[model samples]
Target: MESKSSPCRPQDLGKFEVTQRDGAARLGKFFTKHGVLNTPALLPVVNPNILTVEPRSLWDEFGFRALITNSYVIWKNEILRERATKEGIHELLDFPGVIMTDSGTFQSYVYGDVEVSVEEIVKFQATIGVDIGTMLDVFGRPDMTRKEIEDAVRITAERATKSLQVADTKIMLNGPIQGGLHQDLRAKSAKMMAESEYQQSNFSIHPIGGIVPLMESQRYHDLSEIILSSSSELPANRPMHIFGCGHPMLFPMCIALGADLFDSAAYALFAKDGRLLSEEGTYRIESMVEWPTQSSHISPYTPAQVRAMSKPERTSLLARHNLEVTQRELARCREAVRNGSIWGMAERRSHSSPHLREAFLGIIRERTDPNEPSAKRIRSIIRSTDPIRPSSEPLSEDLLHRPHIIHANSLLVQRWRPPGSWHDGSIGAPSRVVVMKGGEPPWRASYGSTVQRVLKEDPRTVVMIDSLIGLVPYSLEDLSPWCRVEGSNIHPIGTKDADYSVDLESMGLGGIPVLVLTPEGSEYEQDKSILAWIDRCSFVDKLSVLCAVSPAIGCEITDEIRVRRSNTNRPVNVYNGEMHLFSPRLNDGGISLALHGAKLIHEAMKSARDNDEGSTITTTK
Candidate 1:
């Protein structure tokens, strides 16, 4: 007998994947039946009652792949409700891209009640064939009592299974997380919605709801806390939407904290008031002599000319300008993510608003404590990233809190063992750690011979390179990203005496004596003389950082090492006595190993951890 067909799944309707990331912020692609939408993306809120700009223009002219409209607005109007159900949302709006519908949650918050039942809106959205639909979540306002907020969260969560059951298989559903201003409730709500699976139905997106009031009050600190709390519990693969956030000024910070989707009516609302959105902040046309922000919509005419136009004309012009600013800021954020510099961009943008700056500082100053739920959330973000990066650039004091750098430092403390062996078979006490100073990368050139000479004098000495963050062992001169800053004369690359002991203390090497010097004062030595030591020690460092193995065990894997020298007489490849086991990257100095060598590291990982002095740094904040 022939088998029956398989039932539809969430992936059958839509799929989401992370393409690139920095900290918690990521670039994602949402695949749907209509087309792929790249995020972090904005969906301009469309009101059925009015069309300020044609929906077709949003697709062809403005280049947006998705938009959001209120299904309740359509459901309330008999003409719109019938037309949408008959013709579908796309035809009614006259757009070809992905469209998402809301289920009157905000309307309920505003009007205190809605005529439709909870399941009615979900079924209607399915009937109209919206690519994505939001459930009828009860909006949890900031001023509500704790009991009220709890009820909101419980009710919203309870409605998820019914909403998912009613939504069409072709319609990807959004399950909103509602909890007012309480972070615990926010996390609780996210956990419930993300796991709201019932048969062939589950939410495709989780939007942090009840945040419009916070945004309205400029409660950016609370906004950030809400994001961190929900993001910590939300699935990494699914996207997180910052409900009602569209101001360009807040884009960098919101993206940095892990918002993948956003929707706002601010562009039209602000435009009606004659205010223009910009990367820095909003600008009022009446207060402007000229266009402070140059966009194609406003570039042709002077500010005075725009102000002189009729109200309807000016509002339309300003709305287009606001959209221009919004799109430009998102592009800038995507570029920053590629550069591994989104935090720096967030830093620069934060100063434009006092409240935003405070929020940014709160993230920068957060501490990792097991007792603090917020701290645990920050830890999840940092620990989730791969410390090895694809690009290099100049760094500053700003990178001290970089998640990548923190992860590497934590590994250095937890997995790395000090260099010093009495013989090839036994470990010895580390007497002195020679730190190379006033030298920049290519550290192999500036301090290579000096390190060799120091090792020649005291073979038990551990060689280290100084950086703006701290002192890292010479094995990581290039591999530990903090030491990979570009340009020889940059301040962040060179070592400073003030940071020496503190760094040593953190690494649990405080008892060892440190002697700081540069190649300029030292006698040169042949490069080949120390390649064996460099290869063996570098192997241990790489294993510690990347493979999470203790240096003691990593040493066992590299015991039978045979080195291949580059044209510059530097170690290029490592042979485990006979088998080719390791190859070091020329560009970044990171290690690449043969599959056989990977097996060895994998076997040794059972005991991977720090010694008495070694411990995992609270990898974030």
Candidate 2:
């Protein structure tokens, strides 16, 4: 006889794998039929009964790639059950992305009983084309006795076999860790579940549930420790789902600690409570000074306007707002991961949740201090329980100490220490020439080609200073070739608030003779300040002002400074209004333009450094 076929073949089976893990923290991805999911992601919770936001809208408007709904709820409702069974959860929700199903454990905790069996719910989830399914688990509340918690864990593990037996599809199963608030019991549950044959064959996620109440009650330290212990034991390959972590505040720290998946109704819950999710935490509409965002989504109505509307209307709009914020935060997390800055993002987020930050600080301090005993206690506890099965390579110390990079709040003193280069020696003090150049310009449209060519050959630290209109900083390299291709049409690299005057001295752009490229007919104040800074440098050194002039807007160094330069300690090499013009980098990479690229970039560097110019400083407030 032919061997029985595995439900999940190597080709069809999808799962998450940790690429980089720092202690309990990790960076990973989840693969599904729909697409690969970037991990440390929050799966928005959906209620079929409520239908607050359509799943498709969640994907489109909020960028939610995955969402979770209750398989038990669908099974109990005949209409939903029939539709789900016939077409699948994706068809029912009209969502093309991954759809996960909860197994009714939370509802049972709330209502005291549930109608469906564990096997029945798993079957329903599989039949509904769910991407992932949860095995019905007995939830032991935070106040439960140790015996009660142990009993719950045992029962859940016992039922795991039956649930897997009935799950006919390859839908991933969630094996929830239940131990109420007892750390040892939690570890015991994790160990017992991992040891079960059903666990080895079917479970794909180890979610720590029954802790929503704990988190809701502000038992955060308990929640933190529980998560640390429970997650530490689970197989690193499988994603760790936080069953009810919906609030944005918990995302960074949780993701940092190897929690790959999360689901929550916080957006809707907070919306109903008249609270908006902000980076700083939830806020009431009535207390706001100004609008948090300027997009059409929130710009349609001000917070005061929304506050005056009927409660239902206000709630719906606020729910949308909260969801948008949640999605944006998740996007930020993903971007940080891509740029190798996940820890940095987490550190910044810690500031918003002081308690969470305190919890982390406590962990770091305890681990770092020689006198702390928690290390021994923690090691003993984990070793004794041995929840996570020992894998080939254990988490390493080097991984744990990885630096957390964050945006500098003030003028950041980032040491330019690249492997072995300009970052090394203390060169002579800064020159006094300051250059003011137009950014996001007519030059970009008309002369973008030239900019790219110049940048390709330019050795100067080509800093693309911002006028403080956006939230983040950017570099000319980021805008490069793309800006040249799209020219004058290039959108601002950052939003409007990212404005910061070019502080040449601080930026290492100071006191070398300078080239100021101003766009003709542009009067942006920061651009003018750059020119003024250049004038200051002229007092001590030479200042060169280069303009990218359009025929329509005549290009001229309309003003010049004469040589009664200042006696600042810095060298004064200034080329006062020594103007030059260049076209944009050409679309086609021809020899002539390439030659021009080398020449212009070289001349700019020479003029900026050759003269003993005065120091120049530009400020944007």
Candidate 3:
């Protein structure tokens, strides 16, 4: 099942809201009764029975805001059980931040089964006042038969009623999605578990359960399959915990797929086994002449010195190192979300391992939008990306797939309409296209005069700029993006002709007779009539795309056009006669409507409504 971040809502215990996003990956807050916790975060798995790193240090020194422990473990221990119930789990663990209790489900996966039942553990976790709790789910093993996996999923869902019934409302509960290796069953489990069976409440968070063995084997491709298949089915409002997925290498892709919370014992376990974690891959201390990835915990000591230490000392050093690596990588993922560069980070991180690369590419090849339902909303990165970034990046092979670029191109196809006379020429379309190559922005210097001449002569001729981004009409050129590109590294237009052609068709541009023409090096021709025509065309196009007004009506609404240009000779504010109609913001290449323009658009829309009893249309042709 999928989980997403939302920033618009006020959060409380059992409430999750996404504050920011890049693709499906969200930088969000999960409000626990204990406190508000930020994500894409890692919850260091703490064993109540064993303290490799103290829980308080995990919060203070390691900088983790949340940690998970097994309720079953504490429940089995008579002394610890009595202490936890009396003192509360926070007092028992000596931690002040959020504490999440796990059901014996994972222990069930490890040992044959846990002695505790679902009802007892739920009541126990609630009575102990833990902030978050999990139901004992049947861990669907990769080796399980189809019927067995289905039954396991059913058993887990069936337990939700009792689980939520027994759980205290003050604590959030994890509804685990299970299907072993089968993608379909995973989706089914996700949908069934999205809504809590208990009245007046819903599951606070969802964990993708029963895939630890896949992570153990580095079966990342299958792990990605489960995430991609199940994510869309999960509720976008809750955090999706990738249960037991703790390795740093998997964090980038998993977070990118909308897995919000993760808990893993690998940091401690790997340390004891003399292995160190990195975003790339694990390293064995015995083989390391130098630390491939250094941390404060291990940088001062040589591998030989570390190996020479006492067993307990060595374990502590390595565990701290592994913990720091995990913390840094998770922070890196959050920063990527903030910068709208998570896909790029994931791209770079994918090269860390062959399996990771396969998983990244596999998702790329997935034509379906895995971040569905969420992506369909107005705040989805696809609709809300900034038109101009502060700095430009060298384009990658997956440039078209980037969220901002995808958003830009999608808006064009969905909103842009060629002018009425675009097909008014002799060829049943425009006579000449004049496909100007946009090398860098401030487009006026090279193409402005040529565009003016082309439109002056034919009036109906199509003028388009072939940019690093796909097809863009002259009206929208220098608007954004292209203005902010790094010319030195960006691929020249027409180099990726096939990809360009697909996007061009997506824009539904008509077949023009003649294309690509260079600028004529001549003195500027100041023709007033042609200049006004150009202004009208620009106004109509921007209005249609930015405000979703009909170009024909926009032309009707405006009889006068005056453009305010920036120092770069790019249009900033556009006026209709004496009144400001629209402004293409220089700070970002998005259009803002003037009050008068909004009134005009409103009038057009209200007039267009056909449901009113007295509404009628008048023909002008």
Candidate 4:
């Protein structure tokens, strides 16, 4: 008997997998029929009604792999509707990358009401062959009452059922969460959309909608709350889109909050308004003497020359420049995430505007609020910290419950390995805890002799580094935040006498004698007697800090670890226990382990287990 082909499925269409993470920031790849989208990515909103910069240029020039256009806008224009339907959206736009289509939700918000029906828009997008199609959900406005917003959410959900049924197996649908400014309503909407029966089969992305007004008003605090409220209820596997957000200024914070996608028409709109987009903020092109950023489109022409061009020519030039700036910032964000410094990037960007800074603080406060259920969810997502601030920076209220710092401290208490037991078969905690402080790196050069001497004299001592974030064992010295984080050297005011007794207790090191080594300067002069004492210690009593692992460590630990920093400095491959690793001292001041070294450590641990040397390490965060 002839068997029928398997029906089309969402997995067959594309898939999203997180390759690396820093706090809520995820470096992921979303596979699509067209190509792979490296997220968190921005999709420039292209209007078919106008062609400021060709869609093809967005791909070839700017390197945007995905874009979004309004389906309803095409549907309203007979000529565009006919061309789109007959030739397909890709052909119509002359773009070869992934294309997403929006139903008239935003249009409805702007024009009071759209003529298209929910099912009608969904089916139309499918007919045009969009990679992702949005539903015709009701746009909830911030000014709406609770009951009104509730009705909007309910109506959107109701529309979703029929829209999904119509969109089945044809295209990926966007299940947007909308509830205006009400947190509870937003949560309710998110939960419903995330758990909907159709979501399992058809939904490709979850976009938080109805917050454009807030962004326009610069009410970033409320915007932050809305995002947190909606994201807490979203499915972790699926990407979350921050609808109508294109400005580079918002990318760092939004990406830090787990938003995987952003769509904005700002590049063109701002260009039309003579506004130039920048990471700091938008500036009027007419008022600028020099180009804020060098771009092929605007760099050749002086600001005065650009201002003298015809309006259409000027708009096109500025639009290209704006897109270039947006792309650059996105690249910067991706690099930050790779370096485990997204939080730091967010902090730096927040200083661009008072409202943005307030929004960032608001997000921190809300996430740290014990009473908020969403806060708990946020805390769970933070996996690592890239030392949110340097020891020299003043600790603000926002630093207390910073998600990355919290995650780091938690891991320190939980995953960190403690020294092995004594020869008497009795568990022996370290006699004293040594905290290394003062300048960065050359730890081996500065304190190597000191550490060796202390260990040689008393093998039971535990060495820990007091980083800007928290205390981490010597074994994790090369790990993120501790090694790669950059910040001030000054400690926060009023924290000099702060009590860390509870922190000590959490790591099971409470009641132990503590010794702190503060270097007088960048260099530490070694004492020969101390080194000679270290040489006398037994090998079993001294802990071994293993050398580099394999290249897999570079892949797994730091996402896309780069060796080349500049023309002057190039990385040299070195071996750590028969494993190849790249030393990136010149590029970035950090050590990367290779896969073989990692396996060597694993095998050693396994051998210990077989020989019954000691019990496996266990921890509680």
Best by lDDT: 1
Candidates in descending TM-score order: 1, 3, 4, 2
Off by over 4 Å in 3: 1-11, 168-170, 368-393, 421-429, 479-490, 495-508, 519-539, 556-562, 575-580, 594-596, 611-621
- Per-residue lDDT tens digits for candidate 3, residues 1-621, read 112112222345566779998768899887765567899998999998779999878877888878999999999999999999899998898887788888998888889888988898888988888888898889999999999999998999999888888874756788999987777788888988996568766788899998889888889888887886677688789898998899998888888777899999999999999999998999998967888888999989999999999988999899999999999999999998887677678788888999888877766555454443322321343455543454554566766666666666666788776655431222234445567773456666677788777776776677788777666888776555655556522455555433345555666664545467656757578666665555556666767766677665676676556788879556778777878878876554566888987887788777666445222322110
**Superior candidate under TM-score, 3 versus 4:** 3
Residue pairs with clashing backbones, model 1: none
TM-score of each: 0.90, 0.58, 0.87, 0.76
Model 2 per-residue lDDT at 473: 16
- Tens-digit per-residue lDDT, 46-114, candidate 2: 888887778888877766778999988888899998998998888898887778889889999888789
Report every candidate's CA lDDT.
0.80, 0.57, 0.76, 0.72
Of the two candidates 1 and 2, the one with more favorable lDDT, higher being better, is 1
Alpha-carbon lDDT of model 1:
0.80
**Model 3 CA lDDT for position 298:** 94
Residues 324-400, candidate 4, lDDT per residue (tens digit)? 99999999999888866677688888899999999887766665577664565566556444433323223444554
